[model samples]
Structure formats: C-alpha cells, structure tokens
Target: MNDNTSMGNGASQQNHLNGQWQGQPGQQGQGQYGQYGQPQGGYQQGPPQGGWQQAPQPKKKNWFLRHKILTAILALFLIGSIASASGGGSKGSDSASSSDNSSSDSAAKSDDKKSDEKKSEKKDEEKKDEGDKLPAVGTPVRDGKFEFTITKVERGKTTAGSNEFLQETAQGEYTYVYVTVKNIGDRAQMMSESDQKAFSSTGQQFSTDTSASLALDGDNDFFLTDINPGNQAKGILVFDAPKGTKLTQIELHDSFLSGGVKASL
Candidate 1:
C-alpha cells in the first residue's frame, strides 16, 4: 500500500509538469464549479493558433474621384483663364496693327496734300509767265514815261546828208524805221535814238547808226531830243546792216534804263 501511494503522488507531479490539469480530491464545490481551473486576475489567453488576421483597412477614395464636381469646375476655370489671356493678346496685336495702318494713311494724305499744293503753285507761276509775254505789232505800247507807236518802215538807203560837205555814206545798206514817241508823264522825257534796237530773224542784234542819223537832211531823224510831257515826236531811226538782213522785231524804251516793249516788224 505505501508503494501504491508513492506511485500515485509521483504520477500527479508528472501530470502537472506535462501541462495537464487534474481535479483535486475532495475539493468539488458545486457553487464554484464555474471557476474551476481558471486563474484569478491573470493575463488573458493568447491569439488563436492560425496567427492574427488584420481587419481589412477601410479603403480611402481618391481625392479627385471623391469631389468630381469641384474638379470639373477647376478644369473649366483654368481653360477659361487661358482662353481669356489668348483673346486679350490677339486684341492688343490687332489694335496695334490698326493704329500703324492709320498713321500710314495719315502720312500718305499729308504727302498728297503737299504735292497738290506744289502743283498748284507751279501752275500759277506758269500762268503768270504767260501773262507777261509781249503783245502784237500795230498796237500802242506804253513803257515807263512814254508811249511809242511804230508807224511804218523803209529799207535800202545809201546816202543821207543834204550838203555835199556833210554827206555820209553807209558801210552797209541803211534801213529806216518810222516811229512816234509821246511823253505821257508829268515831266519832260528824252527820246534817245540809241535806246532803239532791232533783232534780225536769226536773233542778231543791231544798234542804231547815230552818225548816219545825224547826217539826215531833215529834223525828222531821231536823236537825243527831249519832248515835253503830253507832246509827241516823229522820227526816222537809221540802222546799217549787211545786205539782205531782214529785221524781225524792234524793241523801244522810254529811257536808257527803262523796261522796253517789243513790236513785230
């Protein structure tokens, strides 16, 4: 019996070492049966044998996907801003181009106006030159202090003095021109024979032959003679030139330095 008891005690110790629990003898309490083999206020049991399974984390929605309306509104605003900027730039370029074109047009108009004015002034000058041309023959013309009338002309004379001692012969054939001079001024004015001039058809100028004019028979030769105002003088001017020299025009002046009038011969 002692050997059996020792064997039972050893078996109980061996059961405790092997993590096996056994009920104590005579310790059965009906009210405490719910607390049987449970430790008091100790650590809870570990997780199950399959290892811990992490709960599926709540899935986070993408920011843009969650706020679809706000995203669309932002995209539209960006597009409108770009479009407005582009439109404003185009408008500025067009406005600058228009201003440059307008300035060019104004410059063109100003140039045209200047050109027109120049043309008008040139036409006026031309008209004035035309008005200053000499008139025809047989018309009485007034120079500074006198009015001259060319009456008639005679050509081909050789001898002129009445006296034999005072006779004068022509180097070339002598031509005679008849003229009437009238002093229309307030003072006396001299009719000078030297002031008369003749132009040939070839534009050659001929001066008066004063020596031949002084040798004339009568007092009808034009010399340096003064005539009273409102009086007239008739004279013949002597011009000596080579034979067959046809005089085309005569220029007559009131004084030595006066502006002359031309008459067709």
Candidate 2:
C-alpha cells in the first residue's frame, strides 16, 4: 500500500507543472507570432499580420548648396565691401569733383560771352562816333565851330572877275564851288580861303583861288573875312583844277584845328 501511494503523488505533481506551462504559452516560441495577443509590461500588442515599419530619417543639407545664389551674393558683397574700404572707391567724391569742374567751365563760358559783348558794344560806339553824319550830297555838315552848306557848283570857266579884284585867267579851267558858312563859336571866326579844297576823280587835289574867288560874285563872296558869332556867309570858291578833270568830293575846314567835314559831289 505504501508504494502505490508514492507513485500516484509523484505522477500528479509532474502533470500539474506541465499544465501550468502549457496553459500560458507553447514553449517553442509560440510558432510564427511570437508572444501572440499578449501584453508586454503595461502595453498591449497589435495584430501580428500588420508589422510596424520605421520612418526614414531626414538627411542634412549642405549650407552653401541650400542657398547657392544667396550665398554667392553675400560672399561677393563682403569682398566688395573690403575692397572698397581699402581702395577708397571715391564714387561720390568723384561726382562732386565733376560738378565743380562743370561749374567752372560754365563760369568761364559766361565770362567769355560777357567779354565778347563788351567788345561788340565798344565797336558799335566807335562806329556811331565816326559815322555820325549822313554821307549824301546837298546835306549841311556841321563841324565843331562851323556849319556849311553847298548850293551849286559850276565848272569850265576861263576868266573870273569882279569889281573889287582884277580879272584872272585860270591855268586850268576854273571850277566855281558855291557854299554857305555860319560861325557857331561864341567869338568871331576868320574864314580862310586856303582852307577850301576840291578833289578830282583823277585823284588830283586843288586849293581855292584867292583872286578868282574874290572876283567870283559881288552879291556874296567869302574868303579872308571875319564871321561874327551866329552870322553866316555865302560865297563861291574857284579852283583851277586840271583840264578835263572830273570833280569828285570837297573838303572844308573852319580853322587849322578843325577835323574837316567831307561831302560827296
């Protein structure tokens, strides 16, 4: 009886241990789904068919490659800044200098224009002073101390005479040039017959005849005579110009100091 009891207890203990292990999981690693539908620690398990896949990690980018254009621009800007600082680019300064030069040129041009204008004005004044009188015939010319007018001119006379003087024959044909004169000075002015002159077209100059001029006309004769202030004298001046000489112009003078007046014949 004792032997039978020991064998039965031993068999029951072995079966209990086997049942405990088989109830939890199979010992061979639970076939394809290891630890299938089981909880590990405090977490529950998902379906075995759907396996978890790891997400890919992002790759790092090169700093220069990511912003190549911007990086290049920034690098160039840095280099230019350094270069300009060292070399003194002087862009703004150069502009200032150019403006100064341009202003100087403008001022110079203005000065030149003013000089030219002054020269032109001076020339005009000189012309006005020299050409103050009309150059036409039959117009009276008033010089400093005298006013004179030409009335008529007769030529081709051989004998000239008057009651006061003996008749005289001209070496050449006589030319009678009639004129009127007025003394504009405050005092009496003497009219000189030698001061009268006539020019020929052949460039010959002839002076007035003293004797022939006195015998020219008794109505009015002017030669060596004192003309009172504001008084006038009319007379004919005879000249022995060369024969066949064409008269051109006549010049008259009031005194030795007079700048003579010229009138075209």
Q: Number of the top candidate by lDDT?
A: 1
lDDT tens readout by residue for model 1, 2-109: 999999999978966543343334443222233454442333489977989999998999999999999999999999999999999999999999999999999999
lDDT of 2 by residue, 1-265 (tens): 8888998898888866654444334344333333573332233457456787879999988998899999999999999999898666577678888999999999999999999999877865654443344354567887767888887888899889855357788898998778888999899988886887877654468888887876655744465678999999888878887688866678889976788887766
What TM-score does candidate 1 reach? Answer: 0.48
Query: How high a TM-score does candidate 2 get?
Result: 0.47
- Over 4 Å off, model 2: 1-134, 162-165, 217-220
What's each prediction's TM-score? 0.48, 0.47
lDDT of each: 0.78, 0.75
User: What's the true lDDT of residue 23 in model 2?
Assistant: 35
Worst 10 residues of 1 by lDDT: 25-34
CA shift at 184, candidate 2, in angstroms? 1.8
Looking at candidate 1, what is the lDDT of residue 259? 79
Clashing pairs in 2: none
Q: How large an RMSD does model 1 have?
A: 15.2
